[model samples]
Target: MPRKAPSITHKRSRASKPKVTTGCLTCKVRRIKCDESKPHCNRCLRTGRNCDGYAPPLPRPTAITTQPTSTIAHLPSLSAVLISLPGTPSERHSFHFFLSHTAPQLRGLFESPFWSQHVLQACLREEAIWHAAVALGAVHGRFYAEGGEGGERQMWEGEGFAIKQYVKAISCLTRRGGGERRIDVALMACVLFTCFESLRGHHAPALVHLDNGVNLLLELQSLEKPRNLITQTYPPTPYTPLSALQALLTRLDTQATQLLPSRHTRLHPVSTPPTHYETFISLEEAQRASDELWNYCLYTLQPSYPSPYLHPQPQPSHDDLAHRQASYATALTTYLTTKPPRTAREQQAGHMLRLHTLVATLSLSTTSLPASEDVWDTHTPSFAAIVDLARRIIDLDTDVDIYAPETGRVGLDTGVLGPLYLTALRCRDPMVRREAVELLKKERRREGLWDSTLLAIVAERAVGIEEGGCKSELDTGRISDVDVVFDPEGCRAGVRFLLEGGRGSVEGHRGLVLTTDLPRGQNTY
Candidate 1:
C-alpha cells in the first residue's frame, strides 16, 4: 500500500523538443556541422562552395525493387525547394511565363497531369528542371513577342539566354550523378528540351530528343522485373509520374514513326499487342493505348521494312499481308472492348479514341483492295461516323481554336486531326470528305509532326488528285494510289500521284501546296 501511494505521486517531467541536425546537403557531404538555418545556412554562405539548400531528405527505404540500388531519397516539398530558386528578375519572369502560357499550350486540349502538376513540382525539387523550365518559358515568350511566325532562326538562335539556360540544365543533371531519381530528372529535362526544339522549328533535334526519351522510357517500362514479396516503394515520388511521362512520350512518338530510318521503336514490339487490354483506369491510359494502336495499325500497313530512299520496298506476300491485316483488325476490335473512365474531359477523350478506332477498324477492311477506289464506298457509314465525331470535337473546342492568335496551339496529343484527316483523305463520299477537310481547316494547328494546315491542304489536294477535288463518281481512286514520302532531313514531301490524276493531270496538281515549309519541327502539334 505504501509503495502504490509513492508511485501514484510520481509526475512526468516536461522539456523542450530536441532539434534536428541533419543539416544542408553540402554540409553533410563535407562532414561539417550545420547551424540548421532556413533555406541557406550562414556557414555555407560565408564559405566559397555553393550551398545545395537545406531541407531534410526523405529516407530511401530498402524495398523490393526492379532497380534497388537505383532508388534514392525523396525530394522536399515545393515550398522548401522554392527557397533555393534564384531571385533574378528575368528568371522570375520566365518561370512565371512557363507557368502561365507555355505550360497550357503544351497540354493541348486534354488536361495533362504531367504538364499541369508533375512538371511544376519537379521544377521546384530539381535545379535542372528549373533551368529547363525557365529556358522554355523565355523562348516561348520571345516567339510570341516576335509575332510567332517570322523569327524561326531569329527567335531560336538569337536567344542566347534560353540556350544558355538549357545548357545549364544539362550541366546540373551531369553533376547530379547516378540514381533512378537522377534518371527521372534527366527524362524531365528531355521532355522540356523536346518542346524547346520543337518550338524553335528544329525538327531533327526535337525528334532526336523525343525518340531517345521514348526509347529510354520504353526500356524502363519493359526492363522492370519486379521482385515478388511484401511490395513497397516509399516516397515513390520519382517513380509514379513516369506513367504520365510515358503517356506524353506516346503522343510524341506518334508524331512521326514511318519517317524513322529504323524501326527501333517500342524496341521489341510484340508481333501483336495483347489480345486484350485491361479496362482503362483513366482517360490518359486510353489515349495512350489508342495512339499506340494507331502506330501498330499504321505499321501493319507498311512493308516489313520501309526505305527513306526512292527504291520501293518489296511487298510482303499477299497471305502475309492478309494475316497482318487480320491481326490488326482483331487488335482494334479488342481495344474497343476497354472503355475509358467517365469524367467530362475523359469522356471527350474517349469519344475521340473510339471514333479513331472505328475508323481504323473500317479502314483495315480495305487493306487488300481490288485496285479500285470503289473499295472505300462500302464503308461510307463508318466515314460518316468519323466526320460526326470530329464535328463534335470541333464544337466542344469552339471557344478555343487549334490556332491561337499569338504562339499558336501546339501539343503532343493526337487530337481530332489524325482521324479527321484520314477520313478526308480516304473517304470517297463527297459530303464526308468535305466535312472532314472543313473541320481540319478550322482547327488549323499542328499535331505532332503532322501539320493540320499542310494536312488539310493535302486532303483538299488529295480530293483533287483522286476525284477532281470532289465526290464525283467519274474519277475515283484514279491511278490506284498516291505515295507521299516525308523526308524530314531533306525538308521535302514527295507526293507521287498514282495512275496520274484523272480529273486533272498529276503534274497540274503539283502546284497545289499552299505553305512552303513545316513549322521547322519545333511544335508538338
Candidate 2:
C-alpha cells in the first residue's frame, strides 16, 4: 500500500537555477544584479541617458531604526549640530592651553631629581627593588611609565610588574642547570648586590653587600660549562656575564677610594695637624680604612661572580693606594715626632729619605685628576692632590719609574716618561707633551696605537723644530696628534676656520684640508 501511494511522487532533477539579469543602474538602485554589458543598458538606453553598472548600497542593520518622524522634523542640519556641540567648542578653545600648561608639567616630573630620589627611597621594597634592577639590567627605558593616575602612580605600577618579572627570572636562573642546588649562587649574589647598590646610595652597607656577593660566588665549587644556574630551579632565561659584575664592583671600589678624600678630611697625619680646613689628619688611619674597604671589595669579587666554566686564573694582588698612603702618612707622623738626629746621623737621614720616598709613592698612587676642562670642576680637587703627590715622588727620586710595569705602575708620575699623556694634554704641560711623544713612539713600535689626534698634538707642539715645524698646513695623509681624536663628524668643525681665511687651505680636496698653499714641488712631493 505504501509503494502504491509513492507511485504518485515527483521526479528528481540535477539542473541549477539561472542567475537574474538587470541593467547596472537599475540593479544598483534596486540593490540587485547587473548584467554588466557594455554600451548602454536597456533601461538607460531606452530613457536616452548614460548607464553605470550596478553598485549595491550599504545595508543598515534592521536593529537601527530611524528617529520618530516628529523628532526628525525639528532636527537641525549636521553643520548646525556640530557647531552647537558644547564639548567640541571648549576643546577647540583650550587646545593651546592644554598643550602649554599640561605637557610641560608631565615632562618636568620625568626629569626631576626629586622624582628619582623618591622612587629609589620610597618605593624600594623587595619586589619593587628587584623589578627596578631588572629594568636597569634589561635597559628597557620605555617600560618606565604607562597609564595611571599620575607619574608616581605609573612608576609604582610599572616597577611592580618589572619586579615580578625579575623575581621570575631569578627563579628561572636558579633552576636552569637542574635545580636550585645547582644554581650559581655567586652570580645571584652579584645580581643581588648590584640591585641593592642601585636602590641605595653608595654606602658602607653597599660594600658589605658586594662582599657577600663575592663570597657567594666563591662558594660555587662546581666548574661546569653551559650550566644554567637559574634553570636548576625554574626555567631557562638569559643572564649577564659574571666577569662583567666583578668589573662593575672593581670600578665602584675605585670610585669610592677617589671619593673618600673629599668626604673625610682626616686622610693623612701631619706634625702640626695642618690647620688648613681641608687637610687630611692621618694618612695611616686613612690607609687602614682604605685597606679595609679594598679588602671588602675584593672579598665581594670572589666566588660571588665566578667564571662560568673553569676557575679563573689567579692574578697578582695590588694593595689599595689609599691604604698605602695611610701607612706613609702614619710613618711621616712618626718621623716628625722623632727627636733631632745627632748620633748615627747617616742612618737617620737614610730612614727619613726612605719614609719620604714611601710617602711620595703613596700620594702618587692615591690621586687621580681629570685631564679635561669639562670634568675639571668635578675632578680638580682629587686630581690636584694626586698630581702634587706625583710631583713630590719625582722630586725625591728622579730615577724612579712611576709607571714601571715591574714596580706596579703607581701613579701619573711622568718624570722623563712625560706626565701621564692624558694628564699632560689636560694640563698643557710641555714636559708631559714630550713624554707623550716618547710614550706614543714606544706604543707605536709595540702596538700600532697611533691616531690622527695624537699626531696633531705632536705636530702642534713641534712647531719650533725645522723639520716638524708648526706649519698649520698638514701634508696629505699626515695624521693629527692630540689628546683625543676627532670623529669624521667632528672633522667638519674646521669649516668655520677655513671660511674665515685661517692659515690652513680649505679650497682643495673637496672642502677638507687646513694648510698653506704649497709650491708645486712640495705638492708633488
Candidate 3:
C-alpha cells in the first residue's frame, strides 16, 4: 500500500531448461542424451528408432538450493546416496531372496562361500552382474511363491522381470562400443543363464550356455593358474580356485542327458584309470579318481560309443562288464578306506561313489542274462546293495524340507536321483521297489536342472511296467526285454515290456505311457 503509486507486475519466466533425471533404454543403448519426455523420447522418435520406455526415475540432484551455511557443510551429494539404491522395490526383493534362499541351494556339495561372498561382491560392484543376479533371484522367487494366493500372477510378473533383467544384463555385457570385459563375471552370468533356461525346460539353450561357461571357465582357470591373476581385468586380486564350481558344472552337464550311460559320453572321452587310484591324498582326488572309474564303466556299458540308445538295451558281456567292475571296485575300496568323509560334501561324494559301484556291480551281475524271470533273483546281492545305498542317500539328506507335490524345495543335482531311479527300476522286489519309488516321489526337490517330478514318474512307470509284464512269462521263467524310452524335450516317456523266451513266441505290450506337463498355475520360469 505504501508503494501503491508504482505497483510492479512481475511475471515468472519459464525455467531455462527442463529436468532429465532419467533416459529411455533406447537412448541409453545409443549413448545419446534423452529429452526425458513421457512415454516416448523426442530424440528417439526423431532418429526413427523405436523408443523403449524410459528407465525408472532417479533421485533428484543434491546441489544446495539454500544459502551455504557453516552448520550444513559436510553433507554427501544425493547422487552418492542414491547410487546404492539397487532398483525398483521388486528388484530389491528378488536380490534379497537370492541372498537368503537361492544361494544356499546352489552351493551343492561344496560349502565354499564363493556364491555368498565373491559372486555377491561382484554383483554389488558390476551393474551387469547385478542384473544377472537379480534375474536369477526372480526365477527362484517364482518357486518360493508356490501355493500362495495370487502366486500364479506373481510368477508371471516375476518371469517378465527376470527376462527383462536377463536381456539388460546381456546387453550391458555385450554392448558393441564399450562393454563389460569381466570374463569371470561373464562366466557366472552364463551359468545363471543356463539355470534360467533349465528352469524353463529349455535344455538346448541351457546346454549352449553351459558349453560357453565351460569354455570361459577353462580360460579363467588357465589365467589364474599360469598368470596367478584373478581375471584378465583384475590382476591385483588373488585368484580363488574354482575346483568346487568346476565339479558343480561338470555334474550339471552330466545330468542333462536322459540316461546315466548317455550322460558322460557327450562330454570329454573317459580317461583311463590311473595307477595311483588307491593312494589319493585327499577326498577330492579320491572323488575324481572314482569319477574316472565311473566314467570308464559308463563308457564301457554304452550301447554305442558315438550313438547312444534312447531306450534300454541288453547288458554288456561278462568280460567287458567284469573288467570295468573290477576297476570300479578297486577305486571304491581305495576311496572308502583312504578318503574318509570328513565333511558333508565328502560324505555325499563317498555315497555317490558307492552308488556307482553298486550300479556297475548290478550291471555286471545281470549281464547277458537274457532278461529271464530269474534276472532279479540272480542279481539279488546287487539289488540289495542298491537298496542299501539308496537308503543311505535318503537318510543322509534329511536336511531337505520335503513338501507336497504342489510345492517342493528345488535343489542342486545331488547325483542321488539317478542312482535312486536306477534302484527303483532294476530292483524288482516289491517291497524294495515300492520303497525306492516312494523315496523318488517324496524327494520332490529339483536337482540343478533335473526335474524331480519327471524322474520320479519315469521311474515309477518303469517299475510298474516291469512288474506288470505278462504273468505267463513271470510264472514260466521266460525272458522279456524291457525298454524304457525317455524324451527329455517333450517330457514324455514310455516303457515297453516284451516277453521273448516264452515257447519261442514274442509277446509285446505297451506298459506305461508317461507324459508330464508343468504343474497347474505354475509359470514357465
Candidate 4:
C-alpha cells in the first residue's frame, strides 16, 4: 500500500542520521535500518525474497515544486481531495450508494460526464464534494426506499446522517474561504445542494440554491464581458471539467428561467447568438449545440441577470424572436440530416433535442400576445407533436421503469417532463392534453424545477374545472394560465388560474386558487 512520494526526498535527523532511502518495501515495513545499499537491499538480496524495489520515493509536492500553477490548479484540491475517505462502515455504504445509484440518476438521459466523472473525481480531492456526495446518496436512498418499508425510525436516522454530512460539506467549504478557485468549488456544491432539496420536494429552496450557482457563474468571468451576463454564460473553451460543470449549470439556469419570471436588468443585445453550426462530427458536438441553442432560446424569454430585480422580456421587436427561432430550427434540421444516429441512445437523445426546439418555437409564436391565455389553443397541432415526441422519448429510454427500477423518480436537468407539462397545461384539446396528463401521471419523478406528479395534478384539475365544471367531468369550457406556487417542502403547491366560462366557482377551490398535496403512489416523494 505504500506509494513513493515524487516531490519529497529522504530526510536526515538533527543528529545527522540519514533517513532510510534505498530499501525493499518489505524491509522498510519490518523497520530494518538500511545501509543505504545500492542496486538492491543487502538484507532482501540475502533472503532471496521478491523485492518491490521502492524506486527512490517519488518527491512529494511542495510550494517549491516545479509544476506550473495552472497545471497545479487543475489538480484536485489536496486539502480536501486527499484529506479523508469515508471512515465509518455506514459512511462507506452511503458513499458507495452515491457512486453507484445516486450519481447515475443525476446524469439524466444524456449521461453527462460532469456527474459521472468530474464530480467523483472531485470527491477524491475535496472533502466538501465528498460530504455533499455522501449526503446526496443518503438522501436519494431515503427518498426512494419502498414505502412504509424502511419504517419511521430508520428513515429519521438516515435523514439525520444526511443532514450531518450536508453540514460537514458546508463547513468544509467555509474553512476553504476565498482560496484560489473556491467559487468554482462552491458552484459545484450549490448544484448538489439544489438536487438534495429538489428530491425532498422542496423546490423553492432548490431554486434559491440553483440561483446561487447561476449567479456565481455569471460573475465567474464578468470582467471579460462587463456588461452582458449572458455572454459570460459558457466557457470559451471545452474538454476541461469546469466546462462540463458550466454546461450543467447553464442547463439548470434555463430551467430556472422557465419556472419564475426573473427580476433583473434586461440588457439590449448588440450581438447575435450562436445559431450557425455546420454539422455534428461527434456526440459531444451534438450535445453542445443542443445545450447552447436551448439556453439561447430560453434566454430570449427571461432576459434576467444574476441580480434580483424585476426584469420582464415580454417579446422581441423587429421580428427578432422569430428570426432566431428560424435560425435555430434550421441548425437542428441540418444536424439530423448530416449526423445520423448509430445507437438507440443517440437516437433518443436526438429526439430530446428536437422536443426542446419545438417548445422554443411554440413559445416564440405566443410571447407577443402575453395577455391572451387562449393564444395557446392555436398551437394544438404543435402540442400534439410535443406529446407524441415525449411518448417516444419515454418508450425509448433505457432506464424506464420497465427496464430499470426506481429510475423514474429523479433527474437533475430538463427532460420530457417540461415539454409534457407545457402541453398538458396549454393545449386545449382534451385528447392531446389528457395524453400529456397520463404521461405525467406515470412520471413520479422531479425534473429540476418541474415535478411531473405535482404538475400532472394541476394539469388534470385545470382540465377538469375548465371542462368538468364544479360537479361534472363533461363541459365545453377551458382553463387558462395555471399559476403554481410550490411550498418550500415540495409536498404541496398552491394553484391559481382563470376559467373561461367561470363555471367552477363553487368547487373545493374557492375563486380559482387551490392548495393541493403531491399525489400518492408507489414512490410518491
Candidate 5:
C-alpha cells in the first residue's frame, strides 16, 4: 500500500540533497562556500576579510651578477687592464673584450643619477675626487685603445691607449667643476706625472706632467688648512675642489720643463754645461715630486687599496754586476769620507758605517792579488786604509762610552775586533803581521779578553815558536875549553838564564877559543 501510494502521488522526487561545501577560514567566517581560490576567494571578498594569495618562495639571486660599489673592485680590474695590454694582439684583444664588457657596467654606474649625486656628495664631504678621477682615467684609457686584434703591436698600442686615457680622464675629473670635482683634477695631474715616469721614451713629457701636477699639489696643500677652507656644514663647501684644480694647474707648470736631460747634453755636457745644472735640478725636482706624491697618498688620499703601479722594488745585491760593485764601493767611500749628517734623518749614519765595513771586507776577499810570499806585499796600503777606518769607527764608540747611561752602548763588541785582528794576521807582510799582532794584544789588554777561541789561536802561535827555536845571542867574551850544552827544554832554560843571571861569558865550540888555565866559576877569562 505504501509503494502504490508513492507511485500514484507523482510527488516531486525527494528534494535533491544540498551539495556539501567547505570554505577557507575567510570564507567560513562569512558563512559562505569558498571557491578556495588562492589570494582572494569570493567568500573572503563578501566578508571583507583580507585574502593574501599563496606566495611561492622566491629563488635566491646568483652571485656573478652582483655589482661593485667602491674602489676595491675597480683597482684589480684596472691593473689587469694595464698589465694585459703589453704583449701581443691576442692579449690586447682579450683586454679589449674584457673592457668592452665591463664598460657597460661602468657606464651604467656613471649614468645612474643616484650614483652621480652620491659621488658628488662624497667628493664634497671628503674632498676625494681623486678616487673618481683615477677611476675615470682608467675607464677612458681602456676606451681609447678600442681598436686592435691580438698582436704584440696591438698590445703596446692598447697599453699606450690605456695610459693616455687614464691621463685624460684624470685630467677631466680633476678639472674645475663646471659642476665637476676639483680634487679629482689635481689627483689626475699627479697620476699623469707618475704615468709619464713609468713609460719609456717619455721622460720629457713626464717631467712636464710632473711640474703641472706639483703645482696643483702645492695649491691643494695650502687649501687643506682649516683657515683657508671652511667645512662646517651639511654638504661640505666647494673649497677643496677649487683648491685641487689650482694645485693641478700649478704642478703642470713646474714639471713640464724639467723631466730629462736634452740630447745635446747627454753626449757633451761640458760643451753644454748649462744642461748639467738643468739635469741636476730636474732630478731634484723629480725626487721632490715623488716625495710629495707619496705623502699625499699616505696622508690626504688614504687609499684603501695599495697603488697598482707600486711594485716591490728589487734590492740590489753586492754581486749584481761590475758596475754595481764599483758603484757600491764609490758610495761606501763617499759616505765614509763625508762629515756625519746631523739631523734625525741622517741617524742612519751608524748603519752606513756598518755597511761600509762590510763592503771593505768583501772587497778584500774579492780583490785579485799578485803572488807574494809577504801578505803586506800583496795589499799593504789597502789593508792599512781599512784598518785606519776601523780604528776611527772604534774610536767613535769610545767617545760615546763616556755618556753611557744617556747614549747606551758604545763601539762594536770584542767579537768583531777579534776577527779584525785575525784579518791582520792573514797579511803576508811581516810588518803587517806584527802590526796586527800588536793590535790583537792591545785589544786583549783593553777589553779584558776572555774568549776561549781567541785564546786558542794565541796559544798555538806561541807553541810553534817554542818548538822551532830561536837564534841564540852571540857571546863576546873569550873562554877556554868551552863546553856546549844542548837540552830539549833549552827554550825554557834560556828564558830562565836571561832573567836570573846578570853577567855571563861563553864562546861557540866551532869558533876560535881563548885557552887559559882557569878554575870553574873562579877564573876570569
Candidate 6:
C-alpha cells in the first residue's frame, strides 16, 4: 500500500530455467529451451528446424590421469575416441571379415545376437577383448583363405598374430581383479579365445578358455543374489546380454568336455536343468540332455580313473542309462509330434531337436550294448532312427533353401555332422550310409571344429573297412568311382559287405583298427 502510494511499480519474480549446456547446436543457436533428447531436441522438433546433432562430449578435466579405483566413474566412457582406434591393415581386414562372415556363422538359426552385439560392445572397451576379437578374425580369415597362393604363409602369419594377441589378452585379464565391469570384459575375452581356438582346430585350448569364461560368468551371476525374498521380487535388476553368451559358452563347454578325458567331466551348472523350465523341456533342456548324453557316452567309451590326488570318475549305472534314454525319447516325441511349426525358426528348431534326439539315442544304445555283440547289429534301430531323422532334415532344409536361397540350412554346426558321421559308420546299407557320406562331403566346412572334410575321410575309411574294401583299393586309391551314392528310399534294400575282405589277417583287423582310430584320445566328432 505504501509502495503503491509512492507510485512504485511491482515486478513479478521469474524462476531461472535449466541451462542447456549439452543441447544440440540448433537449439543453442535458436536460444530456446531444449529438452535434450537423443537424435533431436524437442524444441527443435517442435519448431520444425533441422537439428544439428550433439557435439562429442569432452572428458572432465581431472588432475589424476589414472585412478586406482575400479568405479564406473573412473572407467573410460564409450565415447573415448581411442576406445576403438583402428588397427593395422591386415587386422582391420580380418575384423571386417569377422563382422561380415564369422559373426553370422557364430550364431544359431534362432540364437540371440550375443556375439554380434554385447560381446562386440565389450570388445570396444577392453584391450583383452580387442585382441581376442582380432585373433578370432585372423583365424577365420586364414580358414577361408586356405588353398590360395601363399596360403600356408598366410595361415602361419595369422597364427602368429593370434598367439601374440592371445598371450596379451591372458596377461591383461589375469592382472584385472573381479570388478563387475572388468569381469564382463574378461569373460568376453575368454569366450572369444575359446572361439579362436575352436576355429583354429585346437580344442584343448578352447576348453581351457571355456572353463575360465564359465567360471567368471558363474561368479557374476552369483553376485546379484538377494539378501531376502522381498528384495528379489520388489526390484528386478536390469539384465545384461552376457547371459545369452553364457548359455552359448556352456554349450561350448559341453562339446569340449566330450573331447576331454573322463577325469575332466564335472557338474557343469550350465548343463543342468534350468530353474525356468516348468511343464515341458525348453530348447536349453533339450540341449542339456543331448550334451549330457553325449558326455555320458564319452565316459562310457573311455572310462578312466582320476589322478591319485583326485577321486575316480563316476560310472553311470544301468538304471541311469535307462532313465536318460527314456527322457530323450520323450523329448524327441514331444518335438516331432508337436503341431507343425509356424515359423522358419520353429522349423529349424525342430530339425535341431530331432538331430539331438537321434544322436543321443545312438549314443545311449551303443554304449549300453554288450561289448561282445556286433555293434552294428545291436544298434540297428538307432541307425534306422538316425536315417529317418536325417532324411527329414534334408527335406526340410531343401524346402527352406527353395524359399530363401540365402539362408541355406544353418550350416554352422546345426548338430548335423555328428549324427551323420555316426550314421555313416554304423549303417551297412551303402545307399543310406552313402547318403550320410554324401552329406558330409558336400557340407565341406568346419562344423565348430569338426572339419567336414576330416569327418568325410574318417567316415569313408570306416565305410570301406565295414563294407569290405581290399587293402590295395585303400592303398592304391583305386576305390575311386566306387558307387557309394544312392537315393534315400531306393537304397532301402540292405546290402551287407563281409567284414573279412580276403586281405589276410591284416584285413580282418582293419575294422577294429579303424574303430580304434576313430577320433580317439583328444579327438572328437
RMSD of each: 19.0, 35.1, 19.7, 15.4, 38.3, 20.0
Pick the TM-score winner: 4
Cα lDDT of model 4 by residue, 1-525, tens digit: 011122211221212223343455444333346544655567665655434344332223222111112212343322233223434556655675565457766776565667656676666556787788888878777765432232422633447788798899889877864323355568789989988777766667777887787667655534445455534343232223455656776667666656543232122222345534555565556566666655655656553344333233354452675676677677777877788876555677778878988987888788777556688878999999999998888777542311232334467657788898888778888899899988877654667767766666667777766666458433344554455565664355566664454435533432343334444222235
Number of clashes recorded per candidate: 11, 51, 1, 16, 33, 0
lDDT of 5 by residue, 319-376 (tens): 3332333443444445434635442212233333443444334434443343222323
Q: What is the C-alpha lDDT of each candidate?
A: 0.57, 0.30, 0.54, 0.60, 0.31, 0.51
lDDT by residue for model 2 over 1-525, one digit each (tens)?
001012122222323323333446433322224456665456545434335444333222122121112111233322232233222222222211112111121112112221112122211212222333343322122111111113313323233443454455456444534332322233433434443332222233444555555444433324452346523432122123333333334434433333221121111110111211222234333233333333343333223333443354443233444444455455544643463333222222233333333423433443343322333224334334434543443333312211111111111101222223333333334444444443333221100111212333333333222123444343212222222211221111111112222244432422233322111110000
User: Per-residue lDDT for 329-374 in model 1, tens only?
Assistant: 4544455456533333444565676676676567566766654656
Model 2 regions more than 4 Å off: 1-133, 137-158, 169-189, 200-209, 220-245, 253-525
Per-residue lDDT, model 6, residue 6, is 13
**Residue-wise C-alpha lDDT for candidate 6, range 412-504, written one tens digit per residue:** 344676678767866656777887887766552455535554456556666765565536343321111111211122111111222332342
Models sorted by lDDT, best on top: 4, 1, 3, 6, 5, 2
Better of 3 and 6 by lDDT: 3
Off-target runs (Cα >4 Å) in candidate 5 are 1-322, 335-376, 401-419, 444-525
Candidate 3 lands at a TM-score of: 0.59
Q: With candidate 5 superimposed using the best TM-score fit, by how many Å does residue 353's alpha carbon deviate from the native?
A: 2.5
List model 3 lDDT by residue over 1-525, tens digit each.
Answer: 010011121222322233233586555433346888977888766645556564333443232121112211232322232334466766765665565456655765444445645556556555666788788888776765542335333543546788898888888678623332545556667767887766654555666788787665545544225454534443234222344456556566655543423243444322355433335465555556555555555545544543231232344455755765576577667757865765444665577667766675666666556745567665655666676776676565532322112334455544566666666666657777777666666554566756545556555555554566434334323223434444345333344434434333422332222223333223222
At residue 64, candidate 1 shows an lDDT of: 16
